[model samples]
Target: MDFEAMAEYLPLYKDAALLTLGIGWAGIAGAVVIGLAVALIVHFRIPVARQICRAYVELFRNTPLLIQLFFFYFGLPRFGFSISPEFCGAFGLALHGGAYMAESFRSGFESVDRIQRETSLALGLTPMQAVRYVILPQAVTLAFPSLVANVIFLLKETSVFSAISLMDLMFVTKDLMGLYYRTTECLVMLVLFYLVILVPVSLAGSAIERRLRYGSFGN
Candidate 1:
């Protein structure tokens, strides 16, 4: 283990970690948007949109993310739709995460009683107003745990972005190991870095889940 080399590379790792977080968050944000949109479409049974959403979910969920990344990063260029590796990485993560998120959200939406929608309609609310005011809030609360789990899983999966030259934490660690030939130190540091980020996220998710489940919100 090259302690000196590891020390020198610490700053690089820090930057890479930050970059990874940014990419992961971007992906999560996109996923939320995609998930909600698809869930709503599926819920309303929108004619063409529901089928498109189902096809999208199946396509992403069934395929390996690596292949998706490869298609985005490599295959699209053949058709003149060029994108940067970073964009490809983030976009792929979003697309993959969105598929699973859609399922979570759909389940959550379905868990809400259909009577609620009927009640809202009886009270003279437009369908959009009813969904926005009554349906989505309950659905989101119901799906919170699954949503958090998906986000955590997506965060860890950012390591795979290194394959596309995105220079995330895992990529930086691999580079350091290759440079210094300090496999043990690099591996240990990689684990520690991931633990540093993921542990708090897991704890926080649990805490939130408990609060949501209990309907306390610490009040």
Candidate 2:
């Protein structure tokens, strides 16, 4: 715990931390979009669409994220599908993280009651209408907690992008640690950086859940 060692690394530490947050934020945003789309496909139980969605979820969820990152970063180039490291990293993160997210949302949908659905159908709603108006609203409420956890996980998982040279916070931190020899100081800050993003996300999720619950009670 050499304070001076950390002081020596302060500037580099700041740079690396910023990079990590930037990369993580971008990757998480992409994951949220892809994940929600995948989740919806599964939730609706579309014929071929559901199967394809299931296949994607199974394929990505079962494998190591690092392997997927390598596949996107290295293997794709062999097929003339070249992309930047950041692009590859983000693609891999979204695809992989989205798999789990699909499951979380699907489970939430499954948790929805049969009566709510029946009531919606009785109200002259089509299947899509029932889902969009009746089922999905409650499902999202149930899924909110799990989704928030997954978002935090996905954000933390963004660190893996550094392996492919994404220059995210973790990548920057590593470089800073090497340069300034303040491993403790920089890492502590890095942890704080992660919490900075994750904590607010968690709070936002809670707020949304509260609103949903309020709506549910017709209050």
Candidate 3:
């Protein structure tokens, strides 16, 4: 292992890691918004909109993120819709992650006891009020763990951003390996950088899940 080569490449990898995190988190934020909106529509069984959201969830969940990125970055140009690589990366992640997030939230919403909704309505609360005051709180709590897992999954998926020509951590690592033939050093840095990003998130998620579980038990 060439320690000098690894050290020399550190700055580039740092920048790329930041870029990856920025785009990944931005995509995750977008996914949360899209997922929440879709889940609400599905929960309410909002006529045509519910069907449309269902179709969207199935379409995105079944397809590969790379294909989605390619469509956004390359295929769109044929139709004169040229977007930046950054936009493609973030947008594709959002669309892909949104599908899974929607499912997670929808399942959480449905898991709430039907009796609670009925009771809220019997107490003269409007449908939206019932959701806001009764259903949403418990559903969000139920969904928090799944949301954390999805965020981590989406962050890892950012490695595919290289396919769209983004200079993410994976891209920089591969570029350095090819240029300097420092495969061991580059791979080591890649693993280290990823662990640096993911380990804390995993640990934090576990901690939060434990707390939520305990809270649920009224301890």
Residue-by-residue lDDT tens digits, candidate 2, 61-155: 99988899998889999999999886777678778888887787788888999898899899899988998888887877888888888878877
Instruction: By lDDT, rank the candidates, best first.
Output: 3, 1, 2
Winner of 1 and 2 under TM-score: 1
Q: Could you tell me the lDDT of residue 214 within candidate 2? A: 76
Q: Residue 203 in model 2: shift from native, Å?
A: 3.0
lDDT winner: 3
Clashes of each: 0, 3, 0
Q: Write the per-residue lDDT of candidate 1 for residues 1-219, one digit (tens) a residue.
A: 677877877888888888998888898899989999999999999999999999999999999888999999899999999999878888999999999999999999999999999999999999999999999989998999999999899999898989999888989888877887888888877888888889999889888888878866674
Off by over 4 Å in 1: 1-3, 217-219
Listed in order, each prediction's TM-score against the native is 0.95, 0.85, 0.95
Give the deviation of candidate 3 from the true structure as CA RMSD: 1.9
